[model samples]
Target chain A: MKNVFIFTSMLLISLNSYAAPPTFEILIKDHLFYPDELIIPANTKVKLLVKNQDATPEEFESYELNREKVIPGNTQAIIFIGPLSPGVYPFFGEFFPKTAQGKIIAEEEGK
Target chain B: MLLNSVILVLREVLEAAMVVSLFMAFTTVSQQSRYFLLKAIFLGLVAGGFYAYFLPEISNWLEGIGQEITNTMIHLGIFLLLTGFLWLISSNIVLPNRLVKAVMMGAIILAISRESAEIMLYISGFRSDHFLMQSVLSGSLIGLGIGVSCGIFLYHLMIALKPAAATKFICVLVVIVGGSMMSQATQFLIQADWLTSTEPVWDSSHIISEHSLPGQLLYALMAYEATPTWSQIVVYLTSLALMILVIISARFLQGQPKYD
Candidate 1:
């Protein structure tokens, strides 16, 4: 019974770890990304929590990252990106492309 | 600011316009009353406005994956309805008017809802920027004019062809458009982590940048991706094959004398 309990506990722990991904937050104010440039570990999937502070909606679009979502005013959006190779991926707001621009840099671990 | 608005609005409006034109061509070829198509356009625009209005709450749904899921559903809805429409026509059976109208409306509504929602959202952004409002509104008007003109041009071109040829042409366009929807749906699934992402099968961005005007038009018409992943390609081709299969099978089932 003790061995069974240990085995079940180990399985649950492994599943929990796999289920939760690392999360990063980005703020959209005045139609621009707060961290205009962000660096993340290469080849690891991550979540982006984007909060829009402006009184209007902005679409978070990245052709390189293959992600697009509309973050309505005063609301937030969650976007998942990468398991990508080491490189730079550029993104911009579709609504305010000129002012809202950013990039993500993926690098190898310990670099 | 004006040019930006033109491009942005143009891209969305062009897509909606293309689908609407295709349906218009289909109805013209069949000699069906166009009231259904016109009704669909009006209904689609209204529903789209509502969709944009509720977007905030919608975005927060399903653990913040709501947008992806909703768009995916819309994409798939279009694909399925289009398939049904193609199947009914390809069989050469006397199509039920009500059934045809339902499929047409359903597909148009889904497509417009998705595209117009984006346009409405973008336009809503300029509400607070009073200085940019004039340029944005004017640019949007120009974009709307161009997109609608192109749609009209396409519809007239299709009608100018012989009836049989026109039907064949519309069939080909339907397959391509349906394939695009399937490809886009796969992309949404990948973004939502419902499907695994893979390296792109090829990079054609060097040949045709997706940001360019020509690229935008092609993408709007066919969902052209300069760099497409293996999964996206697979889904696209599978959709094309499925659409073709329906046409072929229906012909076989009806034992049509010969291909058009």
Candidate 2:
């Protein structure tokens, strides 16, 4: 009975860990991305929760990521990025490109 | 800021303008009332306003994939309607004028709604900013002017051509335009993870950067992409092939004109 309980707990924990992708929160205020540089684990799909606090609409666009999303003012959007190789992927707010710039650096685990 | 507004608005406006131009030429050739186009434009604007207003809620749908899903639907809807219109024209079925017009108008409405919703959101975003409002509005007007002028120019050019020539030109243009819509829809699906993505077949940014004016115009007219994935190319080619088949069948098959 003690062995079964321990195994069951370990299985559940592992399942939970494998089930969800890492999530990163980004804030868009005054047409700029907070934490202009984001680092994430390489070769893993991740979710970006982008909250736009401004009163205007902005489009999160990246040529490298091939992602484009329009996030309205005071709204949040979820963008899923790739299980990519280690590299830097730059992104920007298409509507306000001058100010809203950022990059995501994917690094190998434990490095 | 002014330049960005102009380019952004121009990009959206040119897309809708191109479609409208084709329909305008068609209506004139068919001697339909101009009021029909006006009514469609008005309805599209109203619908777009509603779409923009409900955007936040819409964005939250489909497990946070709402925006992509909705955009994909809109793009696909336009492509299908355009295809239907082409089928009607090519099938030797003399459908009622109303039916043909309805299909064309449906495509127009969807196209305009998608473009206008983005424009409305963009313009509204600047409404509260007093300092930038003047520049943005001015830029928008300039973009709108240029876009409409281009449409008018295209319409007149089509009408000025020989009737047979015009029809052929229009058919080819329709095929390309519909293919563009299909490619765009595929991109949205890829973004939503509904379609698989692969590495781009080629990179053309060095030849014609997407940021350039000619590139933007080509994008609006032909769905040009700097780095289109393999899936995108396949879908685009398939759309083109389908359209060519329709055109060839219409010209050669020449079945009995059912309506006549």
Candidate 3:
């Protein structure tokens, strides 16, 4: 029974292991998000790679998308967002909310 | 504008200050021991700076799971320390006094390192030459001042309570705080897809969202989740129950002449 449990756990873990989702990168410079606008495909789970190029950290946050994480100065972080109907997802750098802002435009394929 | 900034920083720093202050009273209530604490805090601050600097680089390891792993490890470390201290106190072990002090001190320092990193990140955002920078500085100072004052108040209040009562209060508070760390660690693991989480148990955000001031305060004090997943709920309840049991046992230990 214990052997079965261990095998099942390993199998489940492997299934979720690092399948590289469609990825997009957004850079943080001078406390502002570069390309302030990002476009992604709708109805598919995707990874959003945020690289903070500034000498300070910035927290990438979005209430609409319900995601938040801090990227330290000169560091990069990843956030994953889901399969959904086409829509706009707005995100901002929490540390410098006044300036660091952006949006994700998820649209139909080939649109 | 300044007031808002102050409040924001205060909300962020409050948890760290309270954890440190709790230890201040717990380890040794003597006035002179404060300098000893100051030394530990200074060391923690320096370590926090290093953490902020290297956080990004560290996150780059382990196939992008490094960030989650590092954060979860720190939180787990803190949770274990507090739990161990509680166990020692309850087990009626006339352990070396230095052991208790060391655990409390290490817990406070580690907690400060993680919490202060956020504040450092926030402050780094406003280093511009504009006038806004000046106000932010003042606001951050005020926020820090207020947060520290609250921690001091809690410490004094803890000391004023009857011995048993103080023990109960601190035990409950620390356990909740430690459980929060566990919850947060679970969250990072889930985010990294290392752990499976069931559906969110409830959504009380309409009544009081985690984004609000009071909500944030509760989050810092206790891992108050407006929308907690089933796993988080399970972990919290289990941890809380165990701590209560430990506290009861510790109370029994207190009656022995060895404790006095």
Candidate 4:
């Protein structure tokens, strides 16, 4: 029974270590984006929090990243991006693309 | 969402309400029968919807007029709107009792025209979302309904209170609000590069993005921009200052004391 319990514990630890999640935060304000560029680990799941500070509505979209979502003014939205390989992903305010534009930099965290 | 929606609705409703109330009041007292007032409202609404539907065509034609001409037209439209609003206030005329039906008709027409302009902007691909179009239309309709009901209630209530003061106050409020809208429209045209060349005065993206709620509200209400190009600043300031001067002159000429 003791041996079996140790094996089970080791398996659980391995799974937890392998499944750790990465996170990122983005801010939307005044028809502009902050931290306009971001980098993250390859094949890793990323939690993106987009906080919209504008009084008008805006849509956060990235064709390369395959992400599109509406972030109403004075609200926040979360999106998952990832398992993406190393590349520079461009994103923008689909509504006011001319004024609201930005990019995301995704890279391998480590070998 | 509700609060923001309500604010939007209220702004639109107030304008509609004013129009309806003016119509009702005028018809009750004017030599023209009540039928004329109803016809005027119907005509105004239909014209507004028609303008909205044809905004794409209208904008194309306007664009063909050249950038300078379009800019001039926008500026002129804003100026006339501001002037009419100011005159209404300074003259201390109760909109319903003293405003001619033709003036009310004109005001409604202008409101509809503004709505149509927005539709034009959207259809031109200047604005991406169709949702905004629906929001504007629904909000305006709702506002109109509310405003009309409120105006009727107030008109009756005023009969018991100081009607003259109420009328004067309402007129001033309308002028102030309408004049502010004109200022915003003027600034937008200038920023869109429709007007004269000017440098970017400064950029504030480093501090806060204008996509946020506060930024948008300021932009919508006052044409506030964090990163205003030089030309945009010039146009904004010039138009604002001119509007103020015009309002003052109008008040003085009409023998109405300035509010400030």
On DockQ, the leading prediction is: 1
Cα lDDT for residue B254, candidate 3: 72
Pairs of colliding residues, candidate 3: none
DockQ of 3: 0.32
Candidate 1 contains a number of clashing pairs equal to: 0
Q: By the lDDT metric, which is better: model 3 or model 4? A: 3
True contacts kept of 1: 0.62
Residue A46 of model 3 has an lDDT of 79
Worst 10 residues of 3 chain B by lDDT: B27-36
Residue B98 CA displacement from its true place in model 1, Å: 1.3
> Residue-wise lDDT of candidate 4 within A1-111, one digit each (tens)?
999999999999999787645658888887789888777776566667778786665667664554445454566665666656577778987656666788877777664
lDDT of 1 by residue, B61-153 (tens): 888888899999999999999999888777775334677778988999988998888888888888877899889999989989998999999
The stretch of ten residues in a row with the least summed lDDT in candidate 2 chain B is B251-260
Ordered by DockQ, highest first, the candidates read 1, 2, 3, 4
Interface CA root-mean-square deviation for model 1: 1.1
lDDT preference between candidates 1 and 3, better one: 1
- After superposition on all CA atoms, what RMSD does each candidate show versus the true structure? 2.2, 4.1, 5.2, 19.3
In the range A12-70, model 2's lDDT, one tens digit per residue, is: 99997985678999999988899899999988878899999998899898866778888
